[model samples]
Target: MNRRHARRQGMIALALTGAMIALAGCAPEPDVQPTPTPTDSAVVPYDGPVVFVGDELESFLLTPAEVAEAIPEATGVMNASAVLEQVSDGGGTAAVPAICDALFAEQSLGSVGARVTRWMTPSDPEYGQGRVEVLQFADEQQARDRMDQLLQAAADCGQFTKEAPVTFDAEILDEVDGVRAFAGTLLDIDGGYDWRVFQAYAAVGNVVVMLNQPFTGDRTYDAQAAASLLQQRAGDARDALVADLTENPPVPEEQPVTDAAQPWSEWAIGVDGVGPVLLGDAVDVAVAAAGGTATPPTFDRGPWIVENPEATASMLIQQAEDAETVWYVTVGTRRGESAETPQDGAALPALGDVRVGMPVSEAFAALPGGTIVDVASSGEDYYAVTTREGRLFRFDTEGDAADGTAIIIGITVEDATQRASLRFG
Candidate 1:
């Protein structure tokens, strides 16, 4: 990739996030594509969007505490789905340029995985809300190339359509805390080309953290003030994520595994249910079966969350508008050396002795005809196994394929759905 050297040479003051921050979607089954033999071209990543592979990608995302630190005056914190809305902005009557479409955050950056954090600050009216999002590419090269695309968009795109058509102009700001920054302004076509909106961007290694402070109501828009605020927050967010990942790399749950008389071990996961829990089971019925308590949903259509009595494990139940029927169940834990109950009373069976914290290869052997969606790697990876009886078992694991030990941290049992959102694509 070639580098762009042209610069205006002064620092612009900065401002961006999505629906749920981190791996926060409760949408049950993911529509996966077969793994294509990978090629050398950076332009074409894979035949399909390589996803559910990066385990730490979620860990790399900013946390609520971090978001709070950035927006001290925030009234409240929005859930993960809000981050999705923060990043996605290409809806209107015309074809908006990709750059202008993602003035706040770039949801379609084509990364392997992404995590986001969002907040609302009513105190500052000019910049209504605030957001911080971290996007992860497969490697450093892909991340750099994606940054180049964003910069190009900023430099070339000056016009796009919103509810009202507008003209955009960008100024490349100085890099702060090792993150390249940019300031952008949007002018109304009907309002005599006056500045109406402001946003900012920060491009770092193998990641792009963005900030957005959109106007809440009609207020005097000051481009410099908005830029400065966005810049400070973006730098803070980028630093926080880097420090979190560096200081606290995820630790695998390597607990003792003693084969004991358990309940779900003898039970096989079929298209029906594990034991008493079956598909189309109501929320109360499913929670009763798991012996867990149901918590409130975070987002509007968020899944029903079930917590164990001891809060050791969790189960996410997804059901459409009929109150609780037509259910999809999800539960996971780190697979140990052998079949061992993770917590004392929360004896969640290994779903026929196959659980997380175990090698993905073992899961493949246990459930044959299981296809590998993304190539397995060291940090975090995923594998999807479909049973002969039409049951889908998806695993998100840590470790490496070279050592034949990618430990599972998350697993879900789901049926197919057409309205599912693509995480990577």
Candidate 2:
């Protein structure tokens, strides 16, 4: 009505609008539903009777001529019934009907079963590991299709080479009401015939039924009568895919180092007092009290024996590539010592690093074959020399000194095979 009243009404309306907007912001949104993915309906799960079923593989069937070739003795049989009877007679024992029902009764035709048995024949390497698949399949089609895939998978995994395929063919057999009953040449695959067959019947729909016999053995697996005996124990699920093949061990890579790659100078300790000893010189400074030198006289001790003398001496001077120290032979008869005044030992006067691949070995041999000596390996390349004194003197090549490291050459012997192992430290 009045201008002020109208302004107040407008303000109230603006406040109401702001409140509505805030409430809308705080309210939760509706939850969105996820889309369902489509899956194939043809994938029949592995039920008890039918282990596996492949539409394409099941369609494959052998012709009458192929069947006749598979079983030569059944050639003159008038009908399928005659062949069936023969197969039953060959199949030694009948399986319980209840075992067959568990595999096929509840499902469509793609069921599978297994049987349990021991493989004791000489031809079977797994004879020690008893085999069992005491289950059944809905019918022959399902059984054959699954077996084909399984066999192929095994071959692909290199379990069996293509040139050598494991084969088993037997006969089909059934007893009607405890009396002898028969089913014809039950199944044939890849040139192998099976006369001993265990049937797993499945009622797909109405009167349409399927019989699957997972274990079928031909004459090769056993003679006619023997084949039948194998069937009596049949009626179990197909073998589980747990144990199919083995694995291969891994091989290590090879690493080798040449003579030029050895580290020698790393053994160099310091070049102070010990350096002159290896360089064939000795030094004397002031002594706290005073010192004196000793003289020696050679004696006729015939021969002297020293064990690991050179190695022990080298160990003391090994790291002294640049140092010097006194060296002396002790407690041995000298070659020129008189018997009346025998020489107990001698101060060699000076010590030097025995260089190898040169005149070191020759010099040591000139003194005597048994004379102990320190040998140090040296060359432009890497090298190592062990003297008669059991000392391992290592010398670094130019590259080794530059790298400031040592190379280790390891030799391994395995089963008459000699291999060289190399490592850097």
Please tell me which predicted candidate would have the highest lDDT against the true structure.
1
**lDDT per residue (tens digit) for residues 87-194 in model 2:** 111121222321221221222212211112222223222221212122223343434333333223222332211222322222334432211212222232333432
RMSD of 1: 26.9
lDDT of each: 0.49, 0.24
lDDT of 2: 0.24
Runs of candidate 1 exceeding 4 Å displacement: 1-73, 77-99, 102-109, 123-129, 158-164, 175-178, 187-197, 220-425
Tell me the alpha-carbon RMSD of every candidate.
Answer: 26.9, 32.1
For each candidate, give its TM-score against the true structure: 0.37, 0.15
lDDT of 1 by residue, 1-425 (tens): 11121111111111012333222223334455688997765442222211122233343344566554444465566654311222233343432554554443344334433445567777766656666555544444555565665666677667766556666677776666655667566556463434355555555555555555455334333444434554565456545554554454433222224222335333344455444555667756765676556665666656666555555655566675444563456565323211122432224445556764567667767754333333312233455543312245666666442234766665666543212222211
